[model samples]
Target: MVQDVTLVDGAGSGPAAARIPPAPLGRNRDFLLLWSGASMSFLANRVTTVAYPLIVLWHTGSPLAMSVVSTAALLPLLLVQLPAGALVDRWDRRRLMLVCELGRVAAVGSVALALAAGRVTVAHLAAVAFTEASLAVFYRLAERGAVRNIVHPAHLSTALSRNEARGRAAGLLGQPGGVLLQSAGRWVPFGFGVLGYLVSAVSLLLIRKDFQQERDPTAGRGRMAGEIAEGMRWLWRQRFLRAAFAYVAGTNVLFQMLALALILRVKEAGLPSATLAIVLGIGGVGGLCGALVGGWVQRRARQRTLLIAGAVAWAVLIGAMGFTREPVLLGALYAGTGFVGAVFNVAAAVYQVRTTPDALQGRVAAAAGLVGSGTNALGSFAGGLLLAAWGALPTVRAIAIAMAVLALLAAVAPDLKGELPDDGTDTDAVG
Candidate 1:
């Protein structure tokens, strides 16, 4: 009788095939749960985004004050990036997810209470949003590595593609959902926020230890600073990853400019906030379509081809949006941009996870994210000044042109053209 065999494959420990299963199909149950948890969390996040802004604007009626809350939210990326990623490398990711969600529950729960008690101030709102977003970085860094643990090497691309889609969904639905809830009643959104965190926590419970157990080592000791530094250094060596990070960071700047221009244009035209929300909300449909098609694109399109196409599409769609004030027309343009962004984002996440060592996923994600936060901030500030100087439509056109040029340049990265360094690299199957 033929006997069943199993193997521990890492660092040249087994036949590469045994260690690296086929890019995971739907075979990994635990991975599905993890994706679900993160996806729901993303949707909840979008749903709640408007609660704080609406509350602040409603209470204080000052755009500048609300803007401060937005800016303060970026501080945590600077503060926690290094330690967070290092710790994520060490921590039991499942436990970390549970803990982070609970911490958020407590923080937002307190904010909800304070709001109810009439003690919520601009300062209070800023602190809560910053804390929530900060903890998210920690939970996400921990989860990124944990993904490889649950899924086989074969499934990584599809898994990441699905993950990226959730992000687009969050933007598509989350922002508008938040706006909708705030319209119903401010406190209603907070109640919904609390529930979303609870849902995330509950999903974590369903992901069994056997399914979610990480494949990476949690051993290694150093001063916290050194540990963090080590993670960063490892990521820098990967040629493909470095280019992806730069590409993402640059495009984010363009996104901020577009967003700021949209705001100014609406204000100048005396359009209702509802109109902006609805059009942008519908624009999210493009992201959904992009995400749905991402897996097919990954399988058929060369990496470089997908990236170049996505970048070009992003520039064109955003440019089209610049010329439209009609609600339906702008919605279509925004949706198309969302679609292109989904394709670009999903493809990039898959490439990074495939290229980077499992040990470095958290730090790599953190560094890339840090770049995004800082660049987006600078762009937002620039957007405000541009609006004051040349008006909203000009700013939009400028961003569109920049996107086109950046995409053209970034399209030339060697890996995107199929010189992928990790195309056949067999990595540990992380949970």
Candidate 2:
């Protein structure tokens, strides 16, 4: 029941060549509602992410307690992605999203109430973080799968680009906002998070369309493990997608390492927390610009061109991180990295949306996420060890060198460079 419409463009030399430009997404009621809801949800989630440790530390006065709760929040990404993706594919995505929003509200709100009553403990916080994050994994998978269903294929790239911008904006503001709110009261940030969930739920209700294509009833469908296996098999069969997944996973590790190294460098330089925040915050603007330009870039260049360009840009920018300790220079380097990352994300997301069948969207996305995010988590851990063993500058230089090598190899991949099949089927594999 999603609305179907075409865009209008300027007339060509002949009237027959004239085209309708796609309705601006800002005017699309459903998309606006979806975007608003998602924005609130992402902001809320990020706020809670910032507040969780602050709350735990305030209560227990122990960094160990904070780490425990933080670990709990992240554990779900490793454990929940595969199964969550399977459920997202099998369940009514919209309804599942609604359930997730409500559950998040209850989880976060309970902690707020408990804090207000001075009843919260480290154990309480850890349990809540884990449970809420587990639900979030499902919500995210469902939303990603649902977006393609809600918009015309012509507009999908722009729509996803906007989504990426929303996430970046949320990241830009959420941490500072959460810390500011917490200054007023420990419970304030979580209360705002609860409000965000309420808003997201209402937005879901306002949406007037189904978010999935009709699936054939699978009364005797094999176990969920089988469904997950099928999704993985489909993803593996696409050489381009498979390579993309590996590429992203590898880059995620590099970025994670870079992040930790940057933080260490900043700390070593005795930069003020405000300066560090500003440095990090500046990177979000690049991501915003990248997202804004993603559709334009995709339209003008081949996917291979963009991929290689982004890779080259990434290597140069990240390599620069090892050569600077100045906050301003580091900030610029980070911004460049974020910009390239956003471009790659939008390009990759469009490819995934266009090529994957609706039935497999959730599963494939989840499978991809498992690899990318799981490694990111590992990278965080390994980054610390590398920093400890080799020091920040050396660790960063090593990572940068590895990145250049990887980008060079990726640029030469035949499957990446070859023309995609014109029939919209991307199954053609070139070695």
| Candidate 2 wrong stretches, greater than 4 Å | 1-22, 418-423, 428-431
- How high is the lDDT of residue 42 in model 1? 71
Error of 1 at 265 (Å): 3.7
User: Model 2: which ten-residue window has the lowest total lDDT?
Assistant: 1-10
Tens-digit lDDT track of model 1 for 112-164:
78877877899988988888888888987877766655665556567777777
RMSD of each: 5.6, 4.8
Q: Write the per-residue lDDT of candidate 2 for residues 67-158, one digit (tens) a residue.
A: 99999999998999998888888899999999999999999999999989989989889999998899889998899888866765567788
In lDDT terms, which candidate is top?
Answer: 2
**Candidate 2, overall lDDT?**
0.82
For every model shown, the clashing-pair count is: 17, 9
CA lDDT, candidate 2, residue 340: 83
For residue 211, give model 2's deviation from the true position in Å.
0.5
